[model samples]
Target: MTERYSRQERFTPIGPGGQAQLANKHVFIVGAGALGCANAEMLTRAGVGKITIIDRDYIEWSNLGRQQLYTENDAASLKTKASAAEQRLRAMNSEIKVQGIAQEFEAETAEALVDGADFLIDGTDNFQTRFVINDVAAKIKVPWVYGGCLKSYGIVLPIVPGTTPCLHCLIDHLPQEGSTCDTVGIIGPAVQMTAAYQSAECLKFLTGHSMTVEMVYADVWGREYSSINISGLLNPECPSCSRDAVFPYLKKEKGLKTAMLCGRNTVQVRPDQLSTLSLSDLSSHLENVTDRMKENAELLMFHVEDVRFVVFKDGRTLIHGTENVEEAKKLYQKYIGA
Candidate 1:
C-alpha cells in the first residue's frame, strides 16, 4: 500500500491482506444521492478496484448540502447524478475503475448492472427501488447493505443471502408511507451517519471479515442508537430469498409506466415501449406549446403551463409541479404524443 491507503491499511483489521482484497473487489452501488455519494468516496479512497453507481435523478440546488459528489455547477447545469458522481470518483482515485450509469435501476435493468459486482450497496431513498435491489441481490446470491434516512433518524442493515434475512423478511416492518426529506426534511448529519454505517459494513465484508448481519438504527440528533439481530427475521418461505426462490420482483411485468416521486411533487412517466427520442426535433415541434425550453445532449427541459418537463433520451419524462400520475400521463400524451 502506498501513502494513499497507508492509514487504512495499517488499521489492524484491514491490514495489507484486506487492502489487497479491496484492490480486486468490485462494488455496485445504487443511487447517487447522499448515501451513494458518501459511500462511493469512502470506497474509492479505500482503494476498491472498481465501483459502478447507477442513478436516474439529476443534481439540484438542494442536493449540495449532503450529496457529497455534486457541486454548484453540476446542479446549475442539471447534470445527472450518476455521471457527475462518476466524474468526481474518477478524479479521486484514477487507479480504480468507476462507471456511473445515468438511468433508473428498475427490475428490467437491475440484474444486468449488478452482474459482476462482489457486493451491493443501497443509496436509494425509496422502498420501491430498494425492493428491486433486494430482488436482484437475492437472485444472484450477493450481499447488499441497506441504508435509509429521514429527518434525524436512519437505519442500516446488511443482508447476506442464505445466511441472513433478506429485505423481504422485513417488508412488513418497513416504512410504507411517512415523512420524506422534501416534506419533514432531513439533516446532513443523518445522511452521513447512515452512510458511515453502510460503508463500515461494506469494508468489513470486502476485507474478508465475517459479516455480522444486523439491523442498526440511529438518530443522529437525538443521539440514540440501537441494533438488533435480524437473523430470526429470515423466512424460509420468502418468495424472494427462499431456497426455491422465484424472484417475483424480477418477473417481467410491463415495466413501471408511471411513478410518483416521493416528496418531490414530481411524477415520472415512461412510455409502454421505450424509444430513442430526437431532442432537436422534439424541441422544434414543442416550441409553440412549451416555454423556457432548453436542450442538451442528455435531455431536454421545457415548461408547459405551470409544469416543468424534463425529457430524457430514453423517452422518460419527469413532470414536475404535480405528483398525480394521471395528470402527468395526460400531459405526456397531449404534448409528447403517443
Candidate 2:
C-alpha cells in the first residue's frame, strides 16, 4: 500500500491487518447526495477496496453547498452525482476501485447493483429508497449503516442483519406524512456529522471491531448527541426480519407509484411503458422549441412551462419547480417528444 493511507492505518483500531481487510472489502452506497458523498470520501481515504455508488439525479448548483464531491463546473454541466463522486474518489485513492452508477435504486435493480458487496450504506433521501435498502440488506444478510439528516439534526444506526432491529421495526410503516430536505431545509453541518458517524460504524464493522448497534442521534447546532438503545425493538412479529416480508418494496407492493425527488424539485413517474431516450438527441430536438437546450452525455437540461427539466439518459428526468408527477409527465411529453 502507498503512504496515502498511512495515517489511517496507524490508528490502533485499524492497524495493519484491519487496514488490509478494508482494502479487500466492497461497499455499495445508495445515494450520492450529502450523506453519500461524505461517506464515500471517508471510506475511500480509509482504503476501502471497492465502492459502488448509485444515484438517479444529476449535479445542480444547489448541491455544491453540501454535496462535497461536486464542483461548480460539474453542477453547470449537470453531471450525475454518482459519476462525479466516483471520479473524485478515484483521484483521492487510486488503489481503490470505484464504480459510479447513474441509475435509480429499485428492487429489480438492487440485486444486480448490490451483488457481491460486503456491506451497504444508506445515503438516500426518501423513505421509499431506505425501505427498499432495508429489505435487501435483511434478505442478503448483509450489514448496512443507515443515516439521515434534516435541519441541524441527524441519526445513524448500524443494522447487522439479525442482531439489531431492522428499519421497519423502528418506523413500522412508512410515515404517512414527512418533511423532506427541500421542504424543511437541511444544514451542511448536520449532513457532515451524520455521515461521519455512519462512516465510523462502517470502519468498525469492516475492521471486526465492536460498536454499538443502537441509534445515534446528533444535533450539531445544539452540541448535543444521544444514543438510543433499540436492542429490544426487534419485533418478533416484524414482517421483514421475523416473517420474511418477501421484500415488498422490490415487489412494488410498497413505495410510491409517483415520487417527487427531494431537493431537485422533480416528480418521478413510474409508467408501464419502458422506453429509452438519448439526452443528446432529445436536447437537439428540443432546441427548436426552447433556446435553453443543453445536453451532456448523461443528462440534458432544458426549460418548459417555467419549469427546468434535467433529464437523464435512462428515462429518469428531474423536473424542477413542481412536485406533481402528472404535470411533469405532461411537460416531458410536450417538450421531449415523449
Candidate 3:
C-alpha cells in the first residue's frame, strides 16, 4: 500500500485495484529449490499477501549458483531452504506475510500444508511431489501453476480447476525415467525465466485478467520455444478435472525410497514414521558413536566413513556421497540412533 510498489501498480494490468486483489490472495509454493526460490521472491515483491513455502532440504554450497535466496553462510550452516527463503523474503518485503515450513511435501502432510490456498505453484524437482500437488489441486478446485527446468530448458503450465486440462491428462503415467538437474546440469537463466512466467500467470489469475492460457515450453539455451494446444484435453472423461476421480497420489505407494537431490550429490531416505528428535540431544548422543559429530538446534552434521549425514530436527536427513537409500538409512540409524 506504500510507494514501494508504485512501479508495479503503475502497470496497466496491475493498477491499485489489482494490487489490492493481490494483497488478499494466498499462495502455497511447493519446493524451495531453483524454481521455488525464484518464484517466491517474485510473488512477494509483486505484493501477493501471504505465501507458504515448503521444502525438506537444506541449503548447500551448490545451491548458491541457482537458488539465489540462500547465502554462503546459510549454506555453511546447512539452513533449510524454507527457513532461509523466509528470512531473505521477509527482508525483501515486510508487508508480505511469509511462512516457511521446513518439512517435506508428502501425501500425509501435503493437503494440510496446501489446503485453503488461493493457488499452488510447483517448484518441486521430482515427479512424486508434483503428482501429489496436481491431485490435491484438482480435488479441491484450486488453481495451480506447474513449472519445471533442467539443463537450460523448462516448461510452465497453468491449471484453472474446472477450466483447463489437469496435469495428469497430459500423461498416462509418471515418466519412468528422466534426467535430473544433477545429471544434466541446469542454467540459472532457465530457472528465472520459467519462474517469472509462472508468477505472471498467477498474478493474471488473481487480478481477474483473462489471458490466453497455454502450456509454455522454452529452451533458452537452444533458442527454441513452442506451445502445445491443450485446450482440447479438458475432456469430461478426464479422471481428475472432469470425472472427479479420487486423487490417488494422496495415498501412499511403494517405490524407490532413495532420491538424489537435485543440484547436489546427496541422497535422501524416506524413513518409516518415527518420533522427532531434538538436534542437541541427538548430537550429544551421536558424539559417543562418532568423534566428528556437530550439532545446532536445527541440524546435525556428522561424518561416518566416506559419507556425511546432515540430519534436520524434523527427522529428515540428507546423506551425501551416495545415492543408496538403504545405506543412508543404515548410516542414519548408526550415528543418529534412529
Candidate 4:
C-alpha cells in the first residue's frame, strides 16, 4: 500500500490489515442510480479490489441532482448508467478492477451477476429487485447491505444470510405501494445518509468486523435518527432465509415482467425468456412504423408518436412517455415481438 491509503489505514479498526482485506474483496452492486453511484464511488476510492455494477436505465437530467459519477454530457448522450459509472470508477482508481453491465437485474440473471461477489449492495430503487437480491444472498450465504431513501427519509439494514433477519421477514413493514420519490420527491441528504450507513456496514463486513443486526432509519430534514433490532423479525417459516428456504424470488413466475421506472414516465417490459435480438434487423423492420429510428450495436431507439421505445439485445424494451404497463406491453408487441 502506498501513501494513498494512509489516512484510511491509520484508522484503528481498519488499519493496515483491514485495508489489505478490502483491496482483495469483490463487491457486486445492482442499480447505478443515486445509491449505487455513492456506494461504488466510496468503495472505488477506498481501493476495493473489484466491483461489478449493473443498471438498466440511462442517465437523465433529473438524475444529475442526486446521482454522482455522471454529468450533463452523459445525459445528453443518453449514456447508460452502468457504462457511465464504470468509466468514472476506472478513472478514480486504476489499481482495482471494475466491470459495469448495462442490463436489468431480474430473476433470470440475478444469480449469475452475484455469483462470485464477496459482498452485495442494494442500489436498486424498487423492492422487487431487492427481494431477488435477498433470495440470492440467503441461498448462497452472502452478506449484503440494503438501503433506501425517499422524501428526506432513509433506512438501512445490513443482512448476513443466517445471522440476521432477511428482507422477506420484514416484508409486511416495507411499503409495497405508496407515494414514491416520483410523487413525493427525494432530497440529496437522505440519499447520502443512506449510502453512508451502507458504506460503513460494508467496511465492517469486508474487514471481518462484526455487524449489528438492526435496521437504521433517518430523516435528515426532520432531524430524526433511530434504529430497530430486527433479530425478532427473523421468521422460522420465512420463505427466503428459514431452515427450509425456497428462494421464491428466483423463480421465473415471480420475476418482474413489467416495472415502472422510478420518477420517469417510463415502463420496462421484459420477455419471459431472454432472446438475442438483432438490432439491425429489428431497425429495418421498424422503419415503416417508427420515426427517427436509430440503431447501435447494443440497442435501438425509435418513436411512435409521443412514445419513445428503447429495445435492448436481451428482449427488454423501455417504453418512455408513459408508465402504463399495458400500453407499454402493447407498444412492445406492436414494434418488437420476441
Q: Comparing candidate 1 with candidate 2, which one achieves the higher TM-score?
A: 1
- The TM-score measured for candidate 4 stands at 0.95
lDDT of 2 by residue, 47-113 (tens): 8999999988787788888999999989767678877898999999888899999888887778777
Against the true structure, whose TM-score is highest? 1
Count of clashing residue pairs in every prediction: 0, 0, 0, 0
Off by over 4 Å in 3: 253-258, 333-338
lDDT of 4: 0.89
Q: Residue 14: error of model 4 in Å? A: 0.6
State residue 6's C-alpha deviation in candidate 2, in Å: 2.8
Looking at model 1, residue 206 earns an lDDT score of 93
**How does candidate 2 fare on TM-score?**
0.92
RMSD of each: 1.5, 2.3, 2.2, 1.7
Q: Candidate 3 residues 243-328, lDDT tens each?
A: 65767778875633456676567888655563476888777776776788777777788887898888877677788988666787
lDDT of 4 by residue, 146-200 (tens): 9999999999999988778899887843465778888899988899989999989
Cα-based lDDT for every prediction:
0.89, 0.83, 0.84, 0.89
**Pairs of colliding residues, candidate 4:** none
- Mind sharing the TM-score for model 3? 0.92
